[model samples]
Target: MQPLQNAGYDRAITVFSPDGRLFQVEYAREAVKRGTTSLGVKSDEGIVLVVDKRTSSKLVETKSIEKIFQIDDHIGAATSGLVADARSLIERARIESQVYKITYNEPIRVDNLAKKICDMKQLYTQNGGVRPFGSALIIGGIFEGESKLFETDPSGALIEYKATAIGSGRSDAMDVFEDKYEEGMSLDAAIDLALDAVYEATEGKTSAESVEIAVIEKDTEKYRKLSQEEVSSYIDQLVEKKSNDEEETESEE
Candidate 1:
């Protein structure tokens, strides 16, 4: 017999409360916030996509937990939130890329493909009985000699960023970016910055086995995931630099 607080607006995806907010869409965003940290950084040389897998058990095979995906030869995406929901969007992105190729005889542009996915996500919010996708994506690529990075929300909003993060540790990751991100850093430098951000976000809990990285270089325009050996090398470099910086700070203090 209790009275409704939201006036029943929270019960349906299609309903909006008096405050002009969609409760279901907000809940979907909450799901993304609860997921592990994922981020993207764009530099003059290319783009880097990074994700923390946050493996909770030793027995779980790290390779089987995929958070980064290739949408086309040039475009890649890093996702946070419900993995299954992200898989559906990834599939749609791949199909969109192929369809554009068949129709226009060229690969899809990074922003265009992201818009297409956001359109699909928007459709779910307007229709009754369908819930918003509980996920967010960081899509990056090289298009026509230019680098692009985009972030998509469950409410179907899309934004372009020089460097950005999604999920639980976004604030920590973004603080690092704000301090260190440069507009035209080399691809190697961008990768270093990305590692630094993820390190802060995960509170230094990251290792090669618990992280995934992919990159699209302007020279190659190919989406490539780093191998375990490559990831390990980067992790080692990050650890060494962090140790050195701490030593310097302590000596100064």
Candidate 2:
């Protein structure tokens, strides 16, 4: 169907318009941009993930809304776009991990787990009347004594990343990552850089209360989401650092 008036394009997933554009697919990608931002950074010791968790209403339970998930002891993920889609994909991943364990008597590698999810997402695009998932995932974990990170979109295209950001404010977050990222960063440095990335993305609009963070470490038993108090403390430290820097600039003047 020619969905947009005066625009010469069909807006169906199964059909490509005259301009060689799939409006539905493009719409899904835009949905990811409109959703909350999620970021991941990979380092020698672990992976750090961050998310903006702003809610529209006060009545909703903030704790019940999960922007990040621990898929297994060694795997965790962050989502940008529809939370429902992300949850379904994550559940599928959990089942796939279990299946692999049952069949092979060993845990699935992080790369393989990411591949399986990407394959599942790709299957939808090839089928008639199916819409690509309106979500993107950044998965990170410790596997085979090393840390790994990956990003995948609704198109089922998956790629490894040293650092990546997605969803709303992604451009700003990427700017921070590009400026700060270094190879072989310690876990602590990664976490701090992740915070800076989040801050750059949500600058002037969000606070610690509306942020979510998690870490998957090589030495840790499982993925861990930072507590609210811990997030608050980190925010405070960042604020203090900024204040000090501004004061130093004034002294220089």
Number of the top TM-score candidate: 1
Q: Per-residue lDDT of 1-253 in model 2, one digit per residue for the tens?
A: 4456426443354456666666666777888999988999999888998888888998877788898998888899999998888899999999998999999988789999999999998887767777888899999999877899999988789999999999998999889888889998998888888878887788756578788989988887368989999888878887787779889999999
Error of 1 at 58 (Å): 1.4
State the weakest 10-residue window (summed lDDT) of model 2: 5-14
- Each candidate's root-mean-square deviation in Å? 1.5, 2.4
Error of 1 at 74 (Å): 0.6
Candidate models: Cα lDDT each: 0.94, 0.86
Estimate the lDDT of model 1.
0.94
Per-candidate clashes come to 0, 0
**Candidate 2: where are CA atoms >4 Å away?**
1-12
lDDT of 1 by residue, 109-177 (tens): 999999999999999999988999999999999999999999999999999999999999999999999
Cα-lDDT of candidate 2: 0.86
